[model samples]
Target: MENRHAPDSLDSIYSIDSLRARHQQLAAQEPRLRIRERALRLGVPEAALVAAGCGVHARPLAGTAQALFRELGTLGPLMALSRNDAAVHERHGRYLDIQADGPVGLVLGPDIDLRLFFNSWKHFYAVSENGRHSLQFFDRSGEAVHKVYRTEHTDGAAWDAYVERFATEAGLPVVAEPPGAPEQAEAPDDAGALRSHWLGLTDTHDFFAMLRHFKVSRLGALRAAGADLAQPVAGDAVEAMLGAAAASGLPIMCFVANRGIVQIHTGPVKRLLRTGPWFNVLDDTFNLHLNTEAVASSWVVNKPTSDGWVTSLELYGADGELIVQFFGERKPGKPELPAWRSLMASLCAQPLAA
Candidate 1:
């Protein structure tokens, strides 16, 4: 697929009216132009572009994370999409079993699992285009956090009612605020202490807290853990791992997220396609678009679970942000798959050619 590049600056600069006109014009000229890519090319955030259509194809929506999920459940089956700069994760399912605890929320459905960070979701839009329907949410930087789109199987009547109940007449387009300066995490004071903590991880859920306790970046902790725990892998490890999973019929869990929600795909990825900078999984009910070039580093990370040692392939963007993660599919009482471990070990052993 071809992606359009943005000029140095938007010719007319930004205003809700001007952006809306240009967005429509471009959409007409290049029907395949992706809004997110166009935003980057124009040096604007994606949320701003969507917001510019406030009174046109988009309507503002009111709700917190919890409220939105409750309302969305009524819409029946739909496609939930969440993405970052490097990856796009799409899954189709109903929104069920949603629970909110403070700033965090969970959608624990079988197919549409998500982890939501409400604090970052600052804007929402109920959008309609070419007979398609969707609700999109954005973060402070005008970056999309999550989106739900109506499918043919969805209840059209319920969707219309949901929008009518929540949609607001747009007045002014939302503006993206400046991204805050990144907080610098200090390096671990003692490598031994850090490695000891790493080795003591009883659950992968505790990994984040452990990183915060040590005040170190994920990569920093891995580096300090020495070769035995976190092993550096080739940058193409993602592709290799996916291929292995497909060949081995290993059901795996793939995670891709942005600031708002972590969207997961759990199953075998049968088809892998490489087109330009994108690496894709084109499968029924699930699709993944990954910008392989943006993957700066990959690691084979092992964590001890009560079931046994769990292995994962973690890919990071250039800025040290995690782009995506891959893990063998397993439940609480189940041990990690031997086939998955062997694949990871093989990938680790074969370093990329210099």
Candidate 2:
């Protein structure tokens, strides 16, 4: 199947026509003092100022200053403009307008507000309704960048200070520093805290303890019952045996013998010691095929010795049948038999009426 996921396209929403219109509007509205200050700072002729009420100057540097004027002028107007175009929404208000001639750009905002702009070469300005801030972001070639704003008041300073601290703790670079802010202290190591959190989330100790107990208890019972046959019976037989065991309130573990060709259900009981890879004396294996529908089944258990070890055997037979079932737990291992074996033997040797 073909993959259905694909990303959308990237395109600018602010067009050249919109930028040129805003540029003209700002050029007409510049103040004389503002133009003179900007011209002096940029080493440009005052007569060339667009907002100075002098019109475009004829001086040799007039072209350069006018270029700078247009560049700086675009910033204020662009910041005030808004658009609800589809391309504008695609960027969520962040889109770049690439111009063929001068370096003019426009950035949109979430409210469709024109948020920022840049010009051909000199000066970078940002506008907000509260006020406007100007900074020299570039030289004649637009190379150098500088910080445009900083807070001097108590609240702004404190907020900036906290931001710096947060950045340090988060392992990120601090971009802005507050006035009179103290040097950042090294963040403390969190390795131990992280490890503790992981332990709290996992709580592996209790889980492992339960698992180990289950393994040990089940293995011990299987060994006592002598149901160590390495075969597995059909899925249905195992389910039947498990159901019967559950109904009887007996603790038992069932395992497959002969790699699932047969199953052996083993448990411990006081009488009728039994073990099995349960099979009839003549059949060689308990024939599950004989009674395909019989749901009731039986398994034999043996008594425990004085030493607490049970010599258990299991025999699975069709319910209400006299035929001999399978035998298990025939021999002892490296350990010698304890009194518990005798008790189990006595119990196993008892007679039952089939």
Candidate 3:
């Protein structure tokens, strides 16, 4: 994820021929590397790697990400993929219940859930490789925002028609700015003041506003909020919690996001696996792959909502970037599930020793 290379004209750095050659060479050397990894090695945005194949297997898509969502339902029974550096969340469902207002939007379908930030989305593409089809979106720095991949049950004709409608020319020269640095917590206000703000929270969503008002980083606020509200847990808490949920059939909410989109999964986790350093959730409709080894910190946090105290297990990378989060599956008006609270409590009931 060292996409810190200054924003530069990808076209200027590598011509189509050169990019293809370099990518090929790299791929040959590291056969298992994904396009994202190759792009990182090439010092460009991941989008640039895909862009190099434009007019061939990749077709530059026209219009904005918001506009694309309007007709997304047409491509029935698909997988919506969203990821940050450490985790990848994929859900299979029809793209239904879509809505948008200005730069914010949501896909509230039963199977596919997403919270989108269109302001961060800058490029779109219809990609076809090995007979598989996908619609990819990227941010200003060429980092992927989100991707919709076709599944076996996907409506092939609808996908074709949708692409035909939006597919445009070879595309603008692949352009990207360096991604901004990760946000770090500043020294928060006095502990008591921070606790006051934390206690005043009546809705979990309001937590962001509280941070902005007090100007503390998420972790910083947690640090100053007092141990009663937030406590450090063993990094392996993610694995332990998910495993317990699966065994007990307890439904939970998993959130994985990048700068452009937030993808959510709400239900019981039935199957789990680990390969190398990755931990995976392989269910019939939802799949989550997380780089467990990269977790730098894990926390158990409780926030007051109108319904009651809601609990969450949060994972952060070394740079203090959020990797993923989990909560009990509950609606705004419904109180937090006692079972979920118990589960989190059992996982890390005591705060880490100072």
Candidate 4:
């Protein structure tokens, strides 16, 4: 199988080593008691306070809940006298509120950062002080979802126990192995380290590769429509292009330049072809006939006419530079398309990108 991973270059901006070092440094600077105190001051329950500091399953809540809190919790009274603060109740508040009603999940720290791994069907809510500390609640998604809180006296031990129970009940992936007895060290695997490094770098490469996939897919779709000359085209082609675009981190609507004039060939256009000129089904904007000159410029025509119309398409950016090309008809059985499919599959494994 082709290796479809994001680029390793992203590590420079979001490096695991750097993140780990920062987390450790911050942990060292702030005492456990202080962290617990801050959490409590924000009206967090004792359980949450313990979990945030030293619990095995301690994880940052994500999705709509996080976005909602980031937009509103800070502007409220929750952070009136705390150290940590969030900016809420801004113009963007409505957007966050809408998303909060959608599907979302939490992501843990550096160990599992960027991973959209969720433990349960839960929503995390928050209440902030006057720009100080923030209190968060994790609950089920419902109109009457109950709120749970953590207190100041909540210690690491209590948090750890709760995490263990939660993980056991939910069957979620464990973030780390349980702490061993004092003076004992966990064995390191040299092979595992090497594998991890390669995999991590591959993820970075895949990120950029997705952009290429989008370019190729768009070219293919347009070519299948005969350079917009063919009035109607298969919906499957559009679907394929949109799917590829999504994998590349682009919006679905971005592919459509003009909606009202767009002619979608719902099925096989080849079957509907006649020995005549191409006609526009809508607006009659352009001739239905294919322009041999434009086709020659965009594609290389070398194959026999009896094999059906096949052309190579080269894509250019706004600066008139070549991005990628789609050669010939896009056969569903072709192996070349797998590279794009693999890239998409890896992206799917990630919690839909933030």
Top candidate (lDDT): 3
Worst 10-residue lDDT window for candidate 2 reads 82-91
Candidate 3's C-alpha runs over 4 A off are 1-3, 7-12, 54-56, 179-185, 349-354
lDDT of 4 by residue, 1-354 (tens): 111122234344124354344444555666454433433333332223323333223333444443433333223111111101110010011111212333443222111111121222233423233232233433321111212233242343543443333332222221221122222112222334422332333222242243243333332322332222212223133224334443453311110001001111111111112233221111111112221122222322111122232222232333222222333223333322334333333323222111
Give the CA lDDT, 0 to 100, for residue 294 in model 4: 22
- The lDDT ranking, best first, is 3, 1, 4, 2
C-alpha lDDT (0 to 100) for residue 335 of candidate 3? 92
**Residue lDDT tens for model 2, 1-354:** 111111121111122243234434554565433433443333332222222222231111123222333333222221111111000010011112312233433322221112223332332222121233222232222222221222222134433332232221111111111123222212213434422332332221232242243332222222222322111234243334334333544443222221001122233221221123321111111112222233233333333322223323232333222121222322333222343233223333243111
Q: On residues 172-284, what C-alpha lDDT tens digit does candidate 1 reach at each position?
A: 35555655544446367788998788788789888988888888888788777776678888988888888888887899999997767899888888988999999999887
Candidate 3 clashes: the total is 2
**Tens-place lDDT digits, model 3, residues 244-269:** 89998999999999998999999999
lDDT of 1: 0.80
**What are the lDDT scores of the predictions, listed in order?**
0.80, 0.26, 0.84, 0.26
Q: Tell me which of candidates 1 and 2 scores higher on TM-score.
A: 1
Query: Per-prediction TM-score, please?
Result: 0.90, 0.14, 0.94, 0.19
Candidate 4 lDDT at 6 equals 22
